[model samples]
Target chain A: MPAIEVRNLVKRFGSIVAVNGISLEIEYGEIFALLGPNGAGKTTTISILATLLKPTSGEAKINGYDVVKEAAKVRQSIGIVFQDPSLDDRLTARENLDIHGRLYHMSREERQRRIEEVLEMVELLDRADSIVKTFSGGMRRRLEIARGLMHKPKVLFLDEPTLGLDPQTRRHIWEYVEKLRDEGVTVLLTTHYMEEADYLADRIAIIDAGKIVAEGSPSELKDSVGGDIIKIKCSDAENMLKKLVSNGYDAMLVDDEIVIKAKEAEKMIPKIFAIADEEIKSITYKEPSLEDVFIHYTGKVFRDEEVDEIEASKMKWRMRR
Target chain B: MEDEKMISDIYAIYLREILRLWRQKVRLVTMIMMPLLWLGVIGNAFNSVMNLPTQGDFLSFLTPGILVMTMVFTATISGITTVFDREFGFLKEMLVTPIKRESILIGKMLGGVTQAVLQGILILILAIFMGVKFSGAMSIPGMFLTMFLVSIAFVSLGLAVASKITSMEGFQMVMNFMIQPMIFLSGAFYPTTFLPDWLKIMVKINPLTYGVDAMRYFAIGVNEFNIIADLLILLIFSITMILIGGHFFRKS
Candidate 1:
């Protein structure tokens, strides 16, 4: 049996179905990614597996123990890094680790030993005594990961590990996660970043509207959608879109660029250029991306970049008294 | 299989919970000291300023009220920390840990309970120095037991409120709406004997009234209600809230 097996798991929060009867198995030691847009049930599904939320129906098991029935056992088996940072800024890292250790009934010596090991793993050994508030976003995320690893979990679930980070900080995190992959720990990660999912995950499930739209390896999902991507950039994209489709070619206007998906992009590109009498600016054939695959399945962008600016600004509100 | 420890398990978390209040030591100092002031400043302020009818003196009558109130505010305002933790994601971290979920509840409740007792007792000691007389006062052990039950009831109330709140804003809103009204309604500062007949019936239902009345009843031989009934009601409320609060808390 696989390390993590979710069978027809459905978690509904009132009227909204967060995990709409989705099911998949995460093999032991494999870095599997659940790729989805926000509110697509990725986090909800992860929460169920982590035993944070009980399913409305169906069952999920980790190492053969039911997540709902054997929650303590499931909790013992999995380490989860929630989307939010889960560290006390006032407390030193070592102290945080110690408390968690005590809760799990770890002896003083064993807890101390593991604390040192995890701190070193995240390369925060030097800063272990410092309060978490002093650490940067990337460092705090690393500590969150370290904290999750305090117990050697069978699977580590990271929900959008690099969602709100700079590219450089994100890359640093990517390398750290890669190190975990090498250590033979089965990693189940949810990510909005196409490249992050494609680069790290061995197998990927594309979920949308609380359901799995597609499931395969990175290359497989892209290839399953389009054999090759024929790229074309022109000033009159709308006109170009009309002419290409009128010529019976399956061409999609992706934001500013025109993507023509076909068996052979080399064969399709010349025909596309010949058909369009608009501003022929630039044309280059290229490989497909997870973004393209997502757009192929769902008409909208992978992440609605049009997130409400006001809702995003509320994180800085003075903590309630 | 042997290497799995929980998230950020630290000894300092308990210390940190203490220190979080310690940095704002004014609240801790004020929680206890304010009650002590009632024994001295307020106790004497009324001693000369106005004459209040009681069996012994106003200080003895007021002391138990202040002490129970001390515990009440200590437990009720503790919803603030719960709100703060929700904002900072500290509470969420504790919830998902593999260890017993009850530890998070226990650690937090114990801290609030400790703060309330130490603060209330500090004021009680101040009352002792102020020469406030105690007629029916039990031994030191009996006094400690009374404080424990009262403090536990208060802490349980705070836990109950903390568990349902999602955001700090919601927690604070509820705390302000529920906790303050509870404090004023519980006879923390005034005697319920002065209350109207209908209001007195509500006060009879209010656990704080029983706690304050009973605690004073023990300390200085005041009030007419059975002390055993008061203690039993408060104990039931404490246990019921702890179970309900702890249940919702683990899920949240």
Candidate 2:
């Protein structure tokens, strides 16, 4: 059995279907990423699988235990670092991890040993005695990650692990996440950063508007955009797009530039110049990126707006409380 | 084994609250000072206007009420910590743990109760220092028992209200609207006998009325209702409030 199995999971909050029929299977020791813009249902899917929210339909299992029926067993096997800061800032780093250990029923000696190990793993042993309120944002994130690993869970879910961090801190967190895979731990993370997914994920599922638009390895997803992307800025771009389409080239007019998807763009460029009657201002071609892959599947550019629709929905949920 | 784990989980949550309380130095000073002010200022200020049907002084009559007031105030506002936890995201960390959700609620309620009872004891000591008389050494256990019952009931009620209130401002508004009426109507300031019948009905319905009356019986050798009846009503109130609070907490 897969380490994590989600079968057509659907979670609805009244009229809003937050998670719309999602399915996934993750094997042991692999780092998987759910790449999406905010409100793309990545966090909702993770919440369902972590047994924090009940699904409207379908099912999920962690370590072969049903998320709803065997939720206790599932909880025992999984650790989660939520998108928002969840540590009690008043407590010291060691205290926070100690609380997590006690919650998981670790013995006193085992908790002491594991606390040192996890804190050292996150390079926070020197700051273990310092109160979390005094730590910087990056340090807090690292401590939260350490606390999540306190119980030695089989699967760790990191929801926006390095969100709101500097480039150096983000890289440091990525390295720690990569280290988890070497320890034979399965990791499922969600992020909007294309490079984050590209650099760390063994496989990725590009989700949008509560649906998975595409899924593959980073290179495979880039390759799925069909080979190379060729953009030509030219006079009479409309005429150039018409000429390329009539000549059976896969082309589209984007912002006064003609974009073409061709395998061997260098060879296709000579043919394009031969066919085009319009004056070409400039021409550029490069291999497809994950951005290109996202645009290819969704037909829209990725917007990095800070307004999180999931947080808005959560506010509504809290209001209903 | 499951039961053992649940106990340890509850202990962890309970320990965190204790640690947080210890860290709030200002709150400790206020806890000690507030009772002194109430017993020293209000106990004397009200003595002139207040007349009791019993032989004891007004200060002695007011001591038990003040004790109950300490417990009620501390326990009820203790739920504000829950609202703060929710706002700051720490509650989510606790909720996702492997332990049963009810363990979290129980742990928090017990934590609030511990704080309340400790405050009540501090007030009791202050009341004695202010020349308030008690029945004897044996009354100490009954007084502690009454304080515990009052603490548990109000803490559960506070948490129940908190489970539905998402914001600290909203909770403060509701608590302000609820707490003062519960305190004033419970005969914490004056005797319930001289009040008009309609006002007496409100006093009869207040849970703190029984708790204060029971404590009064132990502290001042005075009895408004049967001690057995008072204890029974407080017991029933505590259990009912706990169930209601636990239900709301689990739902959230």
Clash count list over all predictions: 18, 0
As a whole number from 0 to 100, the lDDT of residue A239 in candidate 2 is: 83
Q: Which ten residues in a row have the lowest lDDT in candidate 1 chain B?
A: B3-12
Displacement of the residue B89 alpha carbon in candidate 1, Å: 3.3
Give per-residue CA lDDT, model 2, range A1-321, as digits (tens). 999998888889999988888889899998999999988899999998888889999989999999999988999899999888889988899999999999999999999999999999899999999988888778888898888899999999999898767799999999899888766889999999999999999999999988889999999999889999999999899888888999999998765667789999999999999997888999999998888888888877677655456546644543343
Candidate number of the best DockQ: 2
Could you list the iRMS of every candidate? 4.2, 0.7
The count of residue-pair clashes in candidate 2 stands at 0
lDDT of 1: 0.76
Candidate 1 docking quality: incorrect, acceptable, medium or high: acceptable
Compared with the true structure, what per-residue lDDT tens digits does model 2 show for residues B1-252?
878878998999999998888878887887898888888988898787777656468988888888888778889888558888887789889878888888888889889999999998888888878888787435989988898888998898888888898877887787688887888998887889989999999999988788888988888878688899999999999999988888887777
CA displacement after TM-score superposition, residue A110 of candidate 2 (Å): 0.6
How well is each residue in A21-47 modelled by candidate 1, as lDDT tens digits? 898988898999999877788889988
**Candidate 2 docking category?**
high
DockQ by candidate, in order: 0.41, 0.88
